[model samples]
Target: MAAPLSTRPVTMVSPFVAGGTNDLLCRLLAENMGKSLGTTFVVDNRAGANGNIGTAFVAKQPPDGQTLLMGNSATHGTNPTLYPNQPFDALKDFAPVCMVAAVPVVLAVSTELGINSVADLIAYAKKNPGKLAFGSSGIGGSGHLCGEIFKTATKLDMVHVPYKGDVPAIQEVMGGQLALAFVGVGPATVGIKSGKVKALAVASSRRASTLPDVHTVEEAGYKGVEVTQWYGLFARSGSPKDMLDRMSAAAKEALAKEEVREKMLTQSIEPTYLPADELNVFYRNEIKRFREVIQRLNIKVT
Candidate 1:
C-alpha cells in the first residue's frame, strides 16, 4: 500500500469504461468513501490494455495514500500468467485493500449449434473432433481458462480463439462467427436473454441468480473447475496501515449496505468483504491455482 500522507483528495483509478460492473462499483465505493471520510474520493477512468493500462499506472504512482487502484481479474489473477513480462507485480507492488466481489463466467453456445447442454456439446465435440471452435475475451482471461478447462476435462479436440474483449467475443458467438464461448455472465446474459445464445453451464460452484436455468460445471460433470472473475482494491506497497485500515473498513461497510448488496446480487456478483489477512490467503490460493492451470495447459503468453 502507499505511504501515509496528509488529508488530501484520493484519486481512485478504474481500469474499465464507465457502465461496466467494475466502473459502477468503483464509483459507488468512491461516493460512499467520500461521504464516510468527509473528503473527496475521485474516480478516474483509465481504460485500455484489458485493464493493464490503469493498473500499471496505479502501480507506478506515488507510494502515498492519495492514489488507489481498483483492480479486477484481468489485472490481478489472469494478467500474471497471460503476460510473461508484465512490468508490475500484482501481489508485491500493490497492498491489498479489500476483495469486492466474485464475477461468474457463463458457458454459452450459439443457437444454430443445436447444443442445449454441456453433455450435448461434449457429445458433438467427440463426434466432430477439430471442427468446433470456441472463443474467449483473450488468451488468459477467465473465459479463456474456462474454455481450456472444459476442453481438457471433456477431452475435446476443438480449437480455441481469443478476442480482445468480452463484447466482441460474445457478439461473434451470437453472430455465428463462433460456435461457443465462456464469458462474464453480465454480457452473456444479454445474448441469452435475446435468444441468440444458449446457456449450457456456469463456471461457478452454484448456479447464477441471473440465469437460474443454467447449471454449474460440476453439475455438467466437470467438478473442481470452478473459476470466478474477481475484483478488488489496492494501493502501492508500503502504504500506511492506518490508511489501508480506513479504506478496508469503508469498503466492508459499503459492501454490507443493503442497497449495494442487492445491486451486486442482481448482477449475480457474490460479495466478499475480506480484510487484509484473509484477502492475502485468498490471493495466494488463487495464484497457486493459476500456476497449476498454466502448467497443465503449457500456456505462455507472448
Candidate 2:
C-alpha cells in the first residue's frame, strides 16, 4: 500500500531559479496546499538548462506522489522543440496534477526608440529592417517564441538577442542596448510604470488587469500573437490516481481562496486552476502549439 500522505513531507521542485514567477507561485501554492492537505510541501530549486535539469531529476524520481514538479511553459511546452535531445519527455514522464496560473507577455520597447504603439514599432521595424532587435529571457522561452510570432505576423526583419533571464533582457532594453523585449508582466510592469520602457501591446487574448492601458496584440491590429506564460503541477508517471486526485483537490481549494487569488493578481498573475484530466489536454495542446511555432520559425537551440 502507498504510504500515508502525512507520513513524509512533499517536495515540489521548481525547475527555475528562486525569485522568479515560477518559484513565487510554487511557494504560494505549496503553502496553501500544505495547509489544505495537512502536510508539508517543500520547494526545491534546481536551476539549469532552461528548467531541464530539475525536470529531468523529477522524471527520474519514484512516482510515489512524494515528489512533484512545478512546471511552466518552458519545461513542458517549448523545450521539446527547443532542445535537440531532451532528457525527459514532458508528457510521457509525468502525470498532470493541476494548473496554477497564467501571466501575460508584455511587448515593451526601449523608451529611447520613441515608439508609442505596436503600429509605430511595426512601422519602424519595416523601415529599418535588420536594424531592429528584440531580446528574450532565453532562446527556448515563451518570450523568445512571442518575438518570433511577432516577427512572423508582422513580417519584420528584426534580430533576436537572448539573455539569461527577463530582468537582464529588460535591463538591456531600458539601457537602449536592445530595441524591444517580450517580457512577462511581473518585470514589465515595473519598467512600464517607471517610464524606462514603453509597453506597446500585451500578447494575450485580453488586456492584463495590471496594465490596463496596454492593448492586446489583436487590438493593436496584429493577429496570431497571443501567448501567455502558464504554470502547472505534475508528478512522475505511474503515480496513484488517488494521490493525483487529492493533490488536485488541494490545489483547487487553495486557488479558490480570496487571499491566494488576490496575491496572484497583485503580481499580475491570473490564478487559474485546471483539474488533472483537463490539464493533460491543455498541456498536450500547448506542446503542439509550441512545436508548430518552432517549426514555422525554424528555431534551433544553440
| Candidate 2 positional error at 10, Å | 1.8
lDDT of 1: 0.83
- The global C-alpha lDDT for each of the candidates, from Candidate 1 onward, is 0.83, 0.88
lDDT of candidate 1 over 83-145, digit per residue (tens): 647688887899988888887888889998899888899889888889999888877778888
- Per-candidate TM equals 0.88, 0.92
Q: Which tens-of-lDDT digit does each residue in 193-227 have in candidate 2?
A: 77889999999988888888889999988888988
Best of the candidates, TM-score: 2
Model 1, residue 197: what's the lDDT? 95
Q: How close is candidate 1 to the true structure, as a TM-score?
A: 0.88
